[model samples]
Structure formats: C-alpha cells, structure tokens
Target chain A: MGRAILTLLWKDLRVELRTKEILTTMMVLALLILVILNVAMGQNVVTVKLAASGVLWVVFTFAATLGLSRVFLVEKERGQLSGILLAPMDRSAIFLGKMIGSTILVLLVEAVALPVFVVLFNFPLGGRVGPLLLPLFLGTVGFIAVETLFSAISAQTRLREILLPLLAFPVAMPALVGAVGATAKVLDGLPLQSAAPELQLLVAFDILFVAIGLVVFEYVVEEE
Target chain B: MVQEDRRAVEARGVKKAFGRTWALRGVDLEVRPGEYLALLGPNGSGKTTLLRILATLIRPTEGNIRIFGRDPRREGEECRRLLGFVGHDSFLYGSLSVSENLHFYARLFGLPDIPARTRQVLEALGLERRAHDLVRTLSRGLQQRVAIARALLHDPILLLLDEPFTGLDAQASRSLGELLASLRQEGRAIIMATHNLNEGLEACDRAVILLDGRVARVMEGPEIRGERLREAFLATLES
Candidate 1:
C-alpha cells in the first residue's frame, strides 16, 4: 500500500514536472491576485496588514480549487482512473497519493507567492517565520484533503468545472477561516500560543476530512 | 494443480441497470482455465457492461459473478489480483512515457524488481523502442500495445479485453492476435469483446453473442467458423 501510494505520488509529480500545467496556472493566478490586491489596497501598511491574511487565503482557496479540479480531471479525461481502480490495492491509497500531490503543488504555489506578496505590499515579517510554518502546512493539508475527494466526486459529473467549487467551498469554509485567522495572528507578531486555537481547528479539519476521504473514496470512484 | 480445475470466470443471472435502463437484464457465462472466449454484440448490446462488471469497474444490479471462485463485489482486491482488463480506452496517462506508465502500474501492483519487470513487458509487447515516448505522442496502435503491457504487468490469470482491436491497423491487429494466441497457449483464460466477427472467431476458442443484455448464442470448436459466426451474430441481432 505504501509503495502504491508513493508510486501514485511520483507519477503525478512527474507529469506536473513535464507539463507544468498545474503549477504554471496556479502561480500565474496567485500572482494576478496579488497584483489585484496591491492595486486595490495601494500599499497602505495598516490596511495591507489587516487585509493581507484574508486576501492571501482567498486567493489561495480559489487557486487551490483550480489546481485540485485538475487533479482528477486529467485521469477522467484519459480514462486512466479505471486503470488505477483495477489495481489490487485499497482505494484509500489513491486518495492519500492525490492529496499529497495536491498539497505539494499548493505549497509550491504559496511559497512563490508569499515572497512576492511580502515585497509587493511592503508587509513586515519580523521574526515569526518559524511559527508561521506549522499553520501553513496544516492549513494546506486540511484544504487539499477535502478538495481532493471533492474533486474526484465532481470530476464524475457533467458540470465538473462548475461543480467542484460549488461542492468544495461550503465544506471547506471552516478550514479557510482557521487558516486566515492563524495567518493573521502570526503576521500580527502575536505569540505562537495566540494562534493555537485556529491551529487546533485546522488540525481537526484535516483529521476529519482525511478520515472521511479514506472511507468514502471507494464509493466516489464507483461508476453510477 | 487442483486450482486449474476451478472456473476462471463464472456469472449467473448477472444484471446491470443504469438508472431505469437495463444494460444487462439477465446473463450467465462460464469460462474454464486456458479458454479464450470472444463476446460479439452490436452497439448497446451490453457487451462493455458485462466486461466492466467482470473487471469490477462496476457492480451488477442483480445476480452474481465469481472470478476464480471469488465474488468480485465481496472480494474485489482479490479478484483484481487474479484478473487483467483492457478496454476501448487505453487507460494510459497520455502525459507519461510508455515505460513510466507501465512502471507506475508495476509499482502499484507491488511487483518486485520494478525495472526488470517493466523492461520484460515492454520487450514482450515490442514497445522497447517507443518506451521513452509519451503515450500521447504515439500512434493509437502503439498506445493500445502499451495498454496491454500495463495490464499484463501483474501476470494475471484471467484477462478481459473489450474491443481490443478497435483502432489498430491490420499489422498491429495481427501482432496483437499473435500475442493473445501465445498467452492462451500459456494457459491463461481470456474474454475478448469485439465487433469483428472473423477476427473474433479466429482468435477465440468459443464465441458468444450478446443481444438485449442476454446471451443470444454460443458457438464452439467447428461451430465457431467465420461465416457461421457472422450468420449467428446477424441472426441473433435480427431476432
């Protein structure tokens, strides 16, 4: 099972590396959002500080959805999902593999966007970079966990392009709120403990979705 | 040795319905070890549905199916371990190179010495030269060969092929027929669904015609001659 999951992750990463489809689209969109935020907010330190967390998450959420939707769309379009299903491994392993791939891609996009965001808005990072990493990882994992499963479900639908965000946004609201709160707290130079509640919420969200994704994934992949 | 006597595939009263439409109303089939059975049917005759059910890609709306004495629904992982399936869709990732695609499936099946296994399958399928080419860049015939290689990677006992020759030219089709013949001689059971009556009858040990979700006719040995098989297929469809 571990080998199967790793192979799946490796396959997805290799495809993305060659095509750069997911990363290119995501990075461009993130940069565009940052540019829009810069134009709308106009380098006002006080306002930028207050809106930075919210804008960053809002952009990440939408861009992540765009990337997540493609996670399974490529498989569905080429009918490769059937091949994966035919493998003699537990279906949850496929979910884990996709979730890991998506999380990595989303993080890469975030990593690129963060520096540009900081420089664009002239926002202060102070010395809180170490404390920020945990929330970023947890939040991204929680977001991708839910999005990956929902993307699979939506990919099977005729209106998948529109259906993915519709199905994912409401379910992903809690995680998004927690991420924004944690980012805001950290950016404000608050003590690590100050964002502990949001971090806990993000962790719980990740666990709940990852558990549900494992159990429900088989049914989702089944042909109607 | 005793396991060889076990039916490679067995289906009784298997029915599959999509929404209110019944693709397979009631079907019964049985294939012995080392037998190659060809499934012939017109469009919408439920041939693909039956193959999908046997592959465990979809569940039956009613009745039962057993692959090597194990129920697909109850023992899907085990059934999959014993079965290999190739359908109209190549099931290969277009963006991945041929070798990469096979390697991925080899790893998924947890086959040891992945590099060696991948090389062996590629060589068997005559895809060694094209192994590094992305699947999307290959011709349809070559892509189909890669699909067959991926399915054969795990060395399944029973192989299910749906319209395997749909897009192949005469040369590629003949090569594929030779490969299936070799596999059959090696004692692997195979069920192939196709529309080409002559090829189907030539390659298979028995031929079954499906019409309106039921087995309309079954022919074996001398009864599976090309002209007779086509006549039976036409007669069944007309009726």
Candidate 2:
C-alpha cells in the first residue's frame, strides 16, 4: 500500500516536473497576490506588519486552491484516472498520494512566497520561524486533505472549476481560521504555547478530514 | 473425471439505467478461460456499458457480474488484480515518456523488479525504440500500443477492450489482431467491443450482437465466417 502510494506520488511529481504546470501557475499567482498586497498596504509598515499574517494566508489559500484543482484535472483530461482506478491497490492510497503531492506543491510555493512576503512587507520574523513552521505544516495538511478530496469530487462534475471552491471553502473554514490565528500569534513573537489552542484545532481538522477523505474517496470516484 | 473449465466472466440479468433511460435492459453473458468473445452493437447499444460494469468502472443498475469468480462490486480490488482494460482513450499521461508511463503502472501494481517488467512490456509492444518519446509526441498507433503495453504489464488473465482499434492504420490494426490471437492462445479470456465486423468475426471464437440493451444474437464457429456473419449483423440491426 505504501509503495503504491509512493508510485502514485512519483507519477504526479514527474508529470509536474516535466510540464511545470501546477508549480508555475501557483508560483505566479502567489507572486501576483504578494505584489498586489504590497501595493495596497506596503506603504504603511505598522499596518502591513499587523495584517501580514492574514494577507499571507489569503494568498496561500487561493493559490493552493488553484494548484489543488490541477491535481485531478490532469487525470480527468488524459483519462488517467480510470487507469489509476483500475489498479489493484486500495483506493485510499490514491487519496493519500494526491494529498501528499498537493501538500508538497503548496509548501514549495510557500517556501518562495514567504521570503518574498517578508521582504516586500518588511515584517520582522524575530527568529520565530520554528514556532511558525509547526502551524504551517499542520494548517497545510488540513487544507490539502480536504481540498484533495473535494477536488476529486468536483473534477467529476461539469462545473469543476467553479464547484471546487464552493465545496472546499466551507469545509475548510475552520482550518483556515485556525491557520490565521496561529500564524498571527507566531509572527507576533509570542511563545508557541500562546498559539497551542489554534494548533490543536488545526491538528484535529487534519485528522478529521484525512480520515473522512480516506473512507469516502472510494465512493466519490465510483461512477454513478 | 473431466475438469471443469474456469470461468473468466459470468454475468446474469445485468441492467444499467441512466436516470429514466435504460442503457442495458438485461445482459446475460459467460466466457470461459481461453475464450475470445467479440461484442457487436450499434450506437447506444449498451456494449460499452456492459464492458464498463465488468471492468468495475461503473455498477449495473440491476443484476450481478463476477470476474474470475469474484464479484466485481464486492471484491473489486481482487477482480482488478486479474483484469486488464483497454478503452478508446489511451489512458497514458501525455506529458510523460512511454517508458515512464509503463514504469509508473508497473510500480502501481507493485510488480517485482519494476525496471525489468517495464522493459519487457515496452519490448513486447515494439515501443522500446520510442520509449523516451512523450506520449503526445507519438503517432496514434504508437500511443495505442503504449496503452496496450500498460494494460498487459500485470499479466492479467482477463482482458476487456472497447474499440481498441478505433484510429489505427491498416498495419497497426493487423498487428493488434495478431496480438489478441496470440493472447487468446495463451488461455486469456478476452472481451472485445468493436465496429469492425470482418476483423471481429475473424479474431473471435464467438460473437454476440446487442441491440436496444439486449442480446440480439450469438454466433459461433462456422456461423461467424465469410459473408454470413456480416449478413447476420445487418439482419440483427434491421429486425
């Protein structure tokens, strides 16, 4: 099962590497959001500092959605999803592989976007990258688990692009709120304990959604 | 004592409906190991729908199907392990090279020695030379060959092909027919759905004509030869 998941992840990664389809679009959109944010709020350092966490997450959420939609679109367009479904492995492996792939792409986008965001907004990190990393990881896992599942569901529909956000945003609201709160606390140089509650919420969200996705994914991919 | 033949596919009273309209009113079919059966039907004749149900891609609105004596719905994973499906679509990732696509599927099946299995399938389909080419860069024939290679990688005992020769050139089509014949000789049960009447009759040991979601006729041996098969096919449609 693990090997099957790895194979699936490897396939998605190789396709992305060759085409740069998901990464390029996500990075460009993330940069565009940053540039727009900088223009609108960069002039006021104090205000930028206060709003930096919210703006960063806003960029991440929307850019991540753009990337997530492509996670299943390639399969549908090339008819590869049927091939994957026909394989002998447990269906949940497909969900895990896609979730992990989307998580990596979202993180890669964040890796670049974070430094650019700091420079553009002139917000102080205060050597709190350690505290920030935990929430980022948890928040991303929660975000991707739900997004990947909904992306699979929406990909089957005629209005996939429009349907994805409509289905994803509502389910992902709690995780988004948790991510925003935890990020804000960390950026303010507070102790990790200060943001423990938000981290807990993010963790619970990840567990709940990941479990739901694994159990319900087989039904979602089955043709009616 | 005579040994009973293992059944590769057995379906009874299978029916599939989309909303109010029925695609397969009732389909009863059985194929033994080593049997090569060709499905013949006009447009919207439920040929693809029945094939999809056996492949476990979709469920039948009514009735039951067993692949290798295993229920496709209840034991789909087990059934899939012994099944190979080649549809009209290539099902290959266009961005990936031929070898990469095969390797990906080999690994998904968890085949031992992925490199060797990937090379073996590529060589079998005469795709080794074009192994490094992206699938979209290949000709339609080569791409379909790649699809075939991917399907045969796991050495499935039952093969389901839907219009496997839709866009092939004459040479490619002939080669594919020979390939299916050889696989049939090896005791693999094959269910092929095609519009090419002559080729279907020539390659298959038995032929079934479906019309209006039902089996209109079944032909075998000398009955599926020469002009008789074509006449029966037309007659089934007109009647």
Candidate 3:
C-alpha cells in the first residue's frame, strides 16, 4: 500500500518537474503579487513584511489550488481516477500520495517566492530565518492537506474549477487564520516558544484535515 | 499457490442502490478459477455496477462479496491484489506518454523490473513506436490498448472488462480477442460486460444476459453461438 503511495508521488513529481507548467505559473503568480504589494506599500518595512507574508500565502493558496486541483482533476477528465481506483492499492495511499505531491509543489514554489519576498520587501530574513521558516512549513502543510481532500471531491463535479474554492475556503478558513496569526508572531520577532498557541492551531488543523482526507478519500475517488 | 476448491469470485445476494434506483437487486454470480464468463446486457442493466462491486470500489447495500476467499468489505486491499478491471473509460492520464503511464502504473503495482515490464507491455500492446507520445495525442484505439496494458500490468488472475471493443477497429479488436484467449489459456478467470453479444459470445466460455438489473438468462458459449445469440439479444432487448 505504502509503495503505491511512493510510486504515485514519484510519478507526479517527475511529470510536473519536466512539464514545469504549474510551477512556472505559480512562481509568476507569486512574483506578480509581490511586485504589486511592494509598489502599494512603498518601503514601509513594518507594514510590508508583516503583511506581505500573510498576503503572499493568499496568492500562494490560490495558485497552489490551481496546481493541486489539476493534480486529480486531470485524472478525472481522462478517467484515470477510475483507472487508479481500480488499482490494487489502498485509497488512503492514493490520498497520501496526492497530498505529498501537492505539498512538495507548494513548498518548491514558496522556496523561491520567500527569497524574492525578502528582496522586494527589504526585510532581514537572514537573521530571522529560524523564526520565519517555521511559519512557511506549518502553513503550507496545513493548506495542502485541506486543499487536497476538497479538490479530490470537487474534481468529480462539472463545475470543478469553481467548486474547489467553494468547498476548500470554508474548511481552509481556520487554517488560514491560524497561519496568519502564527506568521505575524514570527514577523514581530517573537520566539517560536512564544508562538506556540498559533503553531498548535496550525498543527491541529494539519492533523484534522489529514485525518478527514484519509477517511473520506475513498468516497471521492469512487467510480461513477 | 492455487487453493483447491477456491472460487475466484463469489457474490451472494449482492444489492447496489444509488438514491432510490436499484442498480443491482439481489445479484449473485461466481466465476471459478480459469473460467471465462461473458456478461451480456442491454443498456442500464447493472453490469457496470456489478463490476465495481467485485473490484471493491463500491460495496453492496445488503449482500456479501468474497474474492479469492477474502471478504472485500474487510480485506479490500488483499482482494484488489488479485483482480484488475477496465471500464468503458480508458482511465489513463492524457498528458503522460504511453510508456510513462504504463511505467507509473507498474510502479504503483510494485511489480518487479519496472522498465522491463513497461517495455514488455508496450511491445505487447503494439505501443512501442508511440511509447513516448502523450496519451492525449493517441487515437481512440491506441489509448484503449494502453488501458488494457494497464489492467494487465499486475498480472492478475481475475480480470474484468466492460465493453472492451467499444472503439476498436477490426485489427485491434482481433488482437484484443487473441490476448483475452491467451489470458484464458494461462488459467486467468475472465469476465466481460458487453452490449455486443456476438463479441462476448466469441470471447468467453460462458454467456449471460441481464435485463434491468436481473439475470434474464445464461448459457455456455457453445449453446449461444452466431444467429441464436443475435436472436436472443434482440428478444431480450424487446422484452
């Protein structure tokens, strides 16, 4: 079961990496958002970095949604989700593989987006790397979990492009709020220890969404 | 490793319902190891629904299902390991190459020698030349062939196909028929759901006709050949 999970993840990574369509689109979206924000804020260091990271995730979340929805949506369009459902692998394994793939893609896009963000906003991320890193990882992990599960179900519907956001946003709202709170604490120069509550919220959402995805994914991927 | 007295697939009083419509009502069917069964049915006759239940993708509302002596409800993964299915939809990624798709599925099956298996499947399906072309670019016949390659990649003992001849040309269909016969020769249990009773009769050792989620009739292959099958299919549809 787990081997199939790894195989699915590997296939997604290799295919997406070679194609570079989704990743490129995401990076461009991130950079475009960063430029727009920089001009709007105009060198207000306090407001720029404080707000930029949170807002950046807003852009990343939508962009990541585009990519993540494509993950299983493409499978549905081609009817490969049915093919995969027929495979001898566990459905939870399919869920984990998709979650892992989406998580890695979002993280890759953010890795570049983060540095560009520091450059645009003129923040001292080097010294704050330890503090700043925690939010990025926790926030993305939670976002991926929530988006992946909802996207799986939405992929089956006719209005999939519109449906994913409708289903995902309500569930993802709590995670987004927790992420913004945690990142704000990090940006304000609070130690990870002081930011424990928000981090706990993020972690809690991660576990919750993952559990939900694992349990319900079978229904989402069931044959038509 | 074959278990004596083991039926390949057994479903007793299987019932599947979606909303108020009953797709399968008290369907009980079985195929012993190495037996080929042809499930003939008119449109909306529950063949697809029954196939899904056997694959463990859907559970019957009231009845029990056992595959290879393991309960699909409790041991779905174990049951899955022994079966493969292909429906009307090819269920393949349109963006990936034929080789890549097969390779990926083989890897997912955790089959030994991924590259060799990919090559073997592609060669078998006559997909060698177009191995690197994306599936979106392939014609309908080619894509369906890749679907068969995918279903057979795991070397399962029990294979189910739904209307496998839907979009094939004469040459492709003949090749597929040969492949099915070979699989039968290897003692693999095969079951197929087809609107084309002629094709189903030609392909399997046993034939069944389903009318509105019920088994209308069943006959061994030799008993339902040629014009007799055509007449039966017509009479069933009219009734």
Per-residue error (Å), model 2, residue B132:
2.0
- True-vs-predicted CA distance for residue B48, candidate 1, Å: 0.8
How well is each residue in B9-35 modelled by candidate 3, as lDDT tens digits? 898888888879999888878889998
Greater DockQ among 2 and 3 belongs to 2
Clashing pairs in 2: none
Better of 1 and 2 by DockQ: 1
lDDT of 2 by residue, B130-190 (tens): 9999898999989999999999999988889999888888899888999999888887889
Residues B49-128, model 1: lDDT tens digits: 99999999999999999999999888999999989999888889888889889988988888899899899999999999
Computed on C-alphas against the true complex, the DockQ of each candidate is 0.85, 0.83, 0.55
Please, what are the lDDT tens digits per residue for candidate 3 over residues A14-54? 87877787788777887887788788888986677568657
Scored by TM against the true chain B, the candidates give: 0.97, 0.96, 0.95
Higher-scoring candidate on lDDT, 1 or 3? 1
* lDDT values, one for every candidate: 0.90, 0.89, 0.82
Model 3 deviation from the true structure expressed as Cα RMSD, one decimal place: 2.7
For candidate 2, give the lDDT of residue A77. Answer: 79
Ten-residue region with minimum lDDT total, candidate 2 chain B: B1-10
Candidate 1's DockQ:
0.85
